[model samples]
Target: MFPNEWLWRNKLIALLVLVIVIELVLFLVPWERF
Candidate 1:
């Protein structure tokens, strides 16, 4: 609920982004048929 806490949260954001990328590359996108 605090903006300052979020603003200083670099590791959380990096982990979030890494998780999103892994999901997209491993489980979501069907890149083989293209």
Candidate 2:
């Protein structure tokens, strides 16, 4: 595969992981303390 395509795919995966992490943190943490 081309380097550009690989880079794009890596970026997308990284973004998805980041979003999942944020969602998990929000879901696990208590909201009433804020």
Candidate 3:
């Protein structure tokens, strides 16, 4: 099979971005104010 460098790079970048977004929303976002 031929190597696909562009596709691999895009997939990895997408995954990294997804993880960063999830972490920010779950750990950094404040919903309750007292």
Clashes of each: 0, 0, 0
lDDT value for model 1: 0.84
Q: Which stretches of candidate 2 lie over 4 Å from their true place?
A: none
Q: RMSD (Cα, Å) of candidate 1?
A: 4.4
Question: Which of 2 and 3 is the better model by TM-score?
Answer: 2
> What are the lDDT figures for the candidates, one per model?
0.84, 0.96, 0.87
TM-score of each: 0.53, 0.88, 0.69
Model 3 CA deviation exceeding 4 Å by range: 1-3, 30-34
lDDT of 1 at 11: 72
The candidate that achieves the highest TM-score relative to the unseen native structure = 2
TM-score of 2: 0.88
Q: Mark the 10 consecutive residues where model 2 has the least summed lDDT.
A: 1-10
Q: Candidate 1's residue-wise lDDT over 2-28, tens digit each?
A: 788776797789989999999888777
CA displacement after TM-score superposition, residue 1 of candidate 2 (Å): 10
Clashing pairs in model 2, backbone N/Cα/C closer than 3 A: none
